[model samples]
Target: MSSMKYKSSEEFHDHLLGAIEKKRGYHLKRFEEHKSEQDKGAVDALAWAYTLIKFGKGNIKK
Candidate 1:
């Protein structure tokens, strides 16, 4: 990891994309925990469904 500070929103966004792409398990678990904690029932369910339908067919690379 680089010791670089995000100077702009775009930089932060890109950094987040790279982090999520690299740390799949961490991000997924965090999302699940956050959704449960917040009690975002229907919205979270729909998002999960869309994620499965959108990315379910792709090959996972580690």
Candidate 2:
């Protein structure tokens, strides 16, 4: 993985997108271990992306 310090925030956020996919697969695999979906879903990557944009990670305005 590329280090965030060396990459632009745009690059870092792009890389984070891929990581999010992998994380979803991992979390899905552990479904049985979770007592409730809510416990595993305080927020997903897509939601965070909106946050990143809205609060100022990407290009969207608040």
State the lDDT at 47 in candidate 1: 58
How accurate locally, in lDDT, is each candidate?
0.53, 0.57
* lDDT tens digits, residue span 1-62, model 2: 97346256676666666676666656655654774575356336545654564466565222
- For this target, which candidate reaches the highest lDDT against the unseen true structure? 2
**Stretches > 4 Å off in candidate 2:** 1-3, 32-62
TM-score of each predicted structure versus truth: 0.33, 0.42
Clash pairs for candidate 1: none
Clashing pairs in 2: 52-57
Worst 10 residues of 2 by lDDT: 53-62
Candidate 1 local lDDT, 6-54, one digit each (tens): 6775565556545544455554566677855434444455456546544
Top-TM-score structure, candidate number: 2
